[model samples]
Target: MRLRSRLRGEFPRGWCHSAQWWITGIRDLTLNTTAAVATVVFVGEAKRALRHRDEPRTLARLSGTFEGYVASLLVNSGGLAVLVTMAIEEGLPVVLTALLAGWYLPNIAISATVFVVVARSRTRQPAAWAELDFVDQHAPKYGRPPETIEEYRAQQLRE
Candidate 1:
């Protein structure tokens, strides 16, 4: 049995051409789409780390650094992809391919630089994880665990 069924239908011929163009255009932006997705993932992880500071600061710091590296790579790659696409669409011929190569090479260099810089940077002074306490205090109904290990142990003993 086929894992998926292919649908067959007769549609306007113009629609096929339009669809092809649309797909090509979308394919052209693949780098940008990948970068954007990476950026979102990095930012989301960073936010999570920031909100749980008291829970192993080392892990939080590592996560934040990783997020920064990802963000930098995404931004640089996306920028390079945009430049290459513009060069191609403008019909730069052989120069277009050269420009694309130029853009990509520089992006690799930039990514390496950013990765090193982010890795060497210190964790935020206030730390994002510290913010968790405030949220826990304000959202009593959210079922936050006891703030301290002692408190947790005491609560467990009581039960």
Candidate 2:
């Protein structure tokens, strides 16, 4: 029968399609896990850096600003992705999906580039107490005041 021959021809293609889906799922899971671990490590390092109370307030402010920016970008990306998916399901033209992806991909790439620059700059920050004092003097204009190690410890104790 013609139907029997068609089914025979399609059986292997169906198995290949399932295999491709499985591989794609595994790749996504691996990438997600790696990203999660990297985020945890970065947070831990930032917290440790914050423990230096004598450091210029600018460093803290910068870190906070960078973190907030990253968070907002992530939220926006997620919301955009959801909206794109909804539009696709609603039978919107494929061109919309292409446009959305084109817009967000560049934004994400730019964010990542900025993050790298910040991380590198953070590493070069002065660790000396005298440097911190200088930072204190200069940072206030940017709303960053100098904090002393003792003051931070005392505040922690009160809590």
Candidate 3:
């Protein structure tokens, strides 16, 4: 199938001849890449935070850091913000634009405060198997658990 057809019929016939189509395609591609990067960072941060769940302050700081990362990514990358702005420019429905803005504005506020919230946080350390078991509650379907933090770190790094 053609790329134009795969885009949910948003680009009508002969759209390639129009500047709007090029602009929209570029915007979509950029935002999609940004969102994918944000998702990876979010997942990594979540896993790191889970390992440190026993430490309340550390967990909070890690969680806050990830949240800030997401908010900053969104505001800086202009994914949903671009959508709302485009909707307004195209004279789309007020309710639709308002809904998009509702999601966007809070991230603007959040991105502004991320640095203040998580300034001096530390990085992740390997937790014990007992702690991991308590958190995961699932047995490994492979070989034995790591004997030391170094070994566990090596295993995780391999993964």
Best of the candidates, lDDT: 3
lDDT of 1 by residue, 117-141 (tens): 4344333443433443333222212
Query: How far in Å is the alpha carbon of 28 misplaced in model 2?
Result: 37
lDDT of each: 0.45, 0.47, 0.48
**Which segments of model 3 are wrong by more than 4 Å?**
1-57, 60-68, 75-77, 111-116, 120-144, 152-159
Estimate, for each residue in 51-125, the C-alpha lDDT of model 2 and write its tens digit: 543344434443234554365358547756886778868866778777766666555554454455455545665
Whichever of 2 and 3 has more TM-score, that candidate is: 2
Best by TM-score: 2
What are the per-model C-alpha RMSD values against the true structure? 16.7, 22.5, 16.5
Candidate 1: where is the Cα deviation over 4 Å?
1-64, 91-107, 110-147, 150-159
CA displacement after TM-score superposition, residue 7 of candidate 2 (Å): 74
Residue-wise C-alpha lDDT for candidate 3, range 33-66, written one tens digit per residue: 5433343434444455546545544554343334
